[model samples]
Target: MIRTEFPEALYLLILIPFFFIIHYIYIKKKKARLNNLVDKELIKTIAPEISYGKLWTKFTLLNLAYAFIVIAISNPQIGTAIEKSERNGTDLMVCLDISNSMLAEDIKPNRISRAKQSLNNLINQLNNDRIGIIIFAGSAYVQLPITNDYSAAKTFIDVIDPSMISNQGTAIGEALEIANESFGEKNKNKSKSIILISDGEDNEEEAVSIAKK
Candidate 1:
């Protein structure tokens, strides 16, 4: 259906009556002056057919026509095909640190707990990205495989604590290696990114090298 995109513009209709009233006042004052100068009966006899009511009506119609034209120029489209589209997203992995040092209260609550909270907040911002979870302490383990289920990712992140890893030490290298191997079997053509969230206290340089390759 045709609609006014600028409906607020319709308030200009109020001016039309004001303009008509001003014109009527001017015409009345002019007629009074003419009547004082000349015979009112003679003026009526000269222009008996002229009606101010008809003039006012004509002016009102002209304003209406102008308003309609202005509204049309706004380009009202009816039942327009407004296309809504979705885009395929990137493959992302969130590597979280679950080492014993993370239990230290250097950060709010602790490092590991703070990391989990940050992960939850990060997940909240994602839209269509396929994500995975890799929790590493002394060794590495894929807590959740790569999937588009954001809810599942958040669930896995929330459950991760210091107790999740049996032997607690930070092995950032092995975690990266596991992640690289896991991602290798999949389609490598897609945009793959791994976000390592940690205090960088116990990880190794091997993760950078493996990710580079």
Candidate 2:
């Protein structure tokens, strides 16, 4: 099975027949004009090497060469292909705090933006790992499900803000619980872990206890 990289190049083939017709008309006109202006015996004596059949053959060969050149430009290829992918990294859940405290001016350009930048950097270093995101304020929510697609994870992280959660407070315990549930209760993956980003302001005292479990 053969296929061309540029199927559009085939459109040039249509002009070949048009060119042949034009050449035929031009040759006929030139021959008639020569016969009218010059004697046949004198023409044969002056140009004894000229053969109409040979001239036509050369023109056909030129057009065939042009067609071959176009086909070469199209970069035709043969055979099929197969691809394989392997995953060998661990799973991780990132729990980000979007409470009002993250808006503190102590950090340069505020706290949330820096956190997101840090998260993006961390994501850049990961390979073949399934990562999920949990954004929490007064309540907890899963912003991205567990997946190996790091690009989509970075996109979702770029748009995270405190405004996403209407209830504006810290619920660290709930965030941890949501992450745990997302990891699933019977998952045997020992490499699974959670990354929590917060400003040390929280009402949930059981956050540490839940993380331990």
> Top TM-score: which candidate number?
1
lDDT of 1: 0.78
Q: Report how far residue 187 has shifted in candidate 2, in Å.
A: 4.7
TM-score of each: 0.59, 0.57
Give the per-residue lDDT digits (tens) of candidate 2, residues 1-213.
788999899889899999999999989998899899999899999998877888899999999999999898888989775658676678899999998889897997889999999988999999877899999988999999988898999999999988999898888899999988887755575478899999866667888799897
- Name every residue pair that clashes in candidate 1: 138-169
Residue-wise C-alpha lDDT for candidate 1, range 117-149, written one tens digit per residue: 887887888778778888888888899998888
The local lDDT score (0 to 100) that residue 201 gets in candidate 1 is: 64
Best by lDDT: 2
Residue 174 lDDT (model 1): 81
**Where does model 1 exceed 4 Å of error?**
1-81, 201-205
Model 1 Cα shift for residue 47 (angstroms) = 27
